[model samples]
Target: MDSELAAASQWATESNAAVFIRLKTESGVVQAMDSEEGDEEENEEGEGADVIEFHPEFTYPIYGEHERIFGYKGLSINLNYAAGSLATYFNIKYTKRIEQMESTSTVALKADDIDTPMRQILADSVCATQSEFAQQVVHDTRVFRPSGRKVHEYAGRSSQTEQLRYEIYSSSFNDTESAKYHERMQAFVLFFIEGAQFIDTSDERWHVYTVFERLDMNGQTSYSLVGFSTVYNFYCWPDRKRARISQFLVLPPFQGQGHGSALYSYIHAMVLGNSDYADLSVEDPSEAFDDMRDRNDMRYLLKHNAFAHIKGARVEQSAISELQHTHKLSRRQMTRCIEMALLKMIKSVKSQEFGEFRLFVKRRIYAQNMDLLQALDPDERKHKVAESFASVVDGYRRVLSLL
Candidate 1:
């Protein structure tokens, strides 16, 4: 009896492993549609179409912490989307399903119903049938324009050293037409971003910034969705607004090609250019985003005449306040950028200038954690502060190297 139970338990499959996600262009959908009436079953990448495949980074939100589906052998879930408009088709395949009523002189073993959770996750935006999905993909891709007015355009670096044109568009959530399409694309946030939730589109203050690749092929032009950022406008005390970036994501296929930097730069410029916004902030940034933000902010500050002599100077409150007013940055971020600038000025870590810079950073770290340090003895507190200062310096070095 124990041996039989052990054998049945071996059939559990990891949910992340069993799931496959693909982004297909209109040409790929046309190829699939032309083959047969219901030809979306196969999971192969068809020729002459740009089909990108990637897996979910985290599935604990959809599945349990174990992220395992039991009582199934060779379970596969396929999620296909139209790369432009993000129309979705979901399907599941399994080689063998365990019998729920097996008589092993014990309770019956049951298999997890994978479709129920997925249906809820996809929401009403997913098509009910594969044929319906095909028709929707064709129609949506043909008419799909990014949900906003084009605000900026720049060039991207591809692996082949080709300079590709990219455009950034801005839209508000109050636009009903764009909000409907944003609903279809929202599922990607759950798949790619950890601890991310769907936004409430009813609020008129929400805005979306999207990045798309401008593809011109055979005398026809099309735009493919690359990544996007969501920002919310918060009311300031004195008839002003504060902009906070809630979520930002760049698809895995186009991640390392400098697209994200371009998108962030555009948003940063837009926020600063608008006189109505008092400042700009981020809701909850991941470590990767923090590093990217640091590099970009430092780069921008370096271009200003006021920031030219900021290196190795005391990070005074007046200086911070003045820069914050002009740049619309939070005090904490402004302080960190100043530290980065100071570090960049030091010619060598072994020099006297590096010691002054290290002490400057230590002062800020100690002040930030003063409450906690008050409880510890003097030597222990000093040691802890030193550790924190070293970590901050290391982080600064990493960001500066990237710049």
Candidate 2:
């Protein structure tokens, strides 16, 4: 077992490989040939012991790359454990051919063409699920003011009603020099909006697309359409499952209003109504169905009820290590790690009060939670931080939900 593992590790190091196991038995002639080697040579005074001739019965190869990689080693040990006399020898072969294929077949995400209206619609549709206001805007097309007047109108307004007319296109970011930049801007945006992450980004299991909204205001203008992505997980029982979402953003100025809701409505309609994308069915009925049904009812009410119900809750507790890791905090230790780091940086310049430092950390954490800056002392910085945080957190939250 140790020798086989060493060989596999060595092979993997040389070729970037994965391993599996295989089992086989020797043939009759081969077994006889092997047994003949064990016979004692003929002695001067005595005839050689009766020449024992035995051979293996049969042999078969296991299918699949996994078998070839790991099964070979497992078979070696299994054969060795077959007590009594030597039964069979499991052959292990190291192949560079398989490794090359694996390296070449890695799946990658590329930017979609953002030049068409349909693409924009798809992106926006995906994004809508993330932001309630964006959802509403996509659905209604007409944005309503606080007074219930159609004050802000999107493109494709015919007379008074807003029409949904968008297209999708394909683009590539491979030309981008920095892989991280392309991933952060393009791939991460999709994953973040979809509320998921890729354990292996090279795997071809993820599909990403972007939509660009077309505005025909005298001339023409295009806004970044919401991006959408889906992951194919075959491990789930029975059917292959995929989770998808629409528009994931509300432009800074266009936010606060009910555009997000409209976008979400459009996404719900798309997901539930369309067959080409994803299939939404309740799973684990006793657990998820009740809550899902309630949420669905609430959605219906929000659309119909004049007096809508809105609840706001704030939770403050010690951050767990997993939570910190998920949030991308540097320190593994939770208590005072972030706060202490901030204090050290502040004190490096001058003596800062503990209260002021605490406020700064609280604001930073709060901004992360709310997806917006709530600081008033530095209005410009506060606004910038808030907007940036909101944009990122919205995308993050959307993708997280999908996962």
Candidate 3:
């Protein structure tokens, strides 16, 4: 133990970093030595003596003794001594520790730390899910693929359809600075796809996929393609916690042909199989549907499922106030003030970080939306929208503090 402490002291002296000496035995002891002057101070002149001192530059004055050391075995010794500017030295030492522990530990990766492979998959999936033209291509491919025929023959019969699909799915544009504005649209597509979550099954793991199908009409066949991406918040708070669906996308042409409904049904069933309880909120009815017709279609589909609205069709300001009061925010004026504050928090974030923050807010909105949806009352849905938006704003503020 004496040899080990001496070695640690030597390392501290040479590297100009802090050193801690831990003694596991009752006779074991800890001591601090000044790097500037190899001077040692004895602690109380006792038999099982342990001494520790902090350099002047360290935050805490005189690192003498600690009540407890975190994650240490036996008589753990912790030393955080370093030479040079305090911040820089501490940063370097902390970084070294982090790097050393990264491989063996299940550390959470920051939003910025998400890698390129995951990013690319997410982007592709988002584009396929959100774009109307992309959705159509996917739908066309799935619906048309069963009949085997020549591509040209099918195109000849349905030139308009084929051209529309081709224009939407096959067109390519240069990414160079000289590319035309229309050419730059491809980049926007790429950006949106990449920014969107392909597989947000959880904060820890994301999955993305590009889907393609061949359609056959009589003897002619054409190919259609689409992308599917999902972001799941699995085990976000804890490993045992249930997962939340962050994002789901299917392209435009696929909208009315039961593809979206089918996908949702499949997901719903899958989730139901795994757990007796699962929930998601649909906050953006506008984004969810291309038009009123599409929205109505979705309404019909949702109605078929056992899902019901929580309150009723329309959520009024009064209802929100009532809910707020129930939560103990009580004063109507105070709740309004709080709501405004939350909105400001969200709006204050940098544009690039907005999307990330938006995901966090959307989950809360969804939860509120589910309450309204489950109510199966028309008035409740309207009120739920207002309530849901308020909840989103409030949730955004809370997320800001986390950053």
CA-only RMSD, every prediction: 2.8, 27.6, 25.7
Clash numbers, per candidate: 0, 62, 55
Per-residue lDDT of 80-129 in model 3, one digit per residue for the tens? 11110000001111111111223323443211111232233222322221
In model 2, which runs have C-alpha deviations exceeding 4 angstroms? 1-184, 187-201, 209-211, 219-236, 244-247, 257-259, 274-297, 300-403
- What digit string (tens of lDDT, one per residue) describes model 2 on residues 1-403? 4554444443322111221111111122223334456442211111122112111111111122222222121121111100111112222232222222223234331212112322221212222211232233233222211111111223433433233333332222332322222243332232123232223445444333333343333342223232222323232244434333322443222334434444443444444443343333222222222223333323443344311221111113433344333322223122233333333334333344544554554565555545334344467665665575455334333433432
lDDT values, one for every candidate: 0.81, 0.30, 0.30
Native-referenced Cα lDDT, model 3: 0.30
For model 3, where is the 10-residue window of minimal lDDT?
Answer: 82-91
Could you arrange the candidates by TM-score from highest to lowest? 1, 3, 2
Candidate 1 vs 2: which has more lDDT: 1
Ranking by lDDT: 1, 3, 2
lDDT at residue 63 of model 3 (Cα atoms): 22
> Roughly what TM-score does model 3 have, to 2 decimal places?
0.26
Pull out the clashing pairs in model 1: none
When summed lDDT is taken over every stretch of 10 residues in candidate 2, the lowest stretch is 77-86
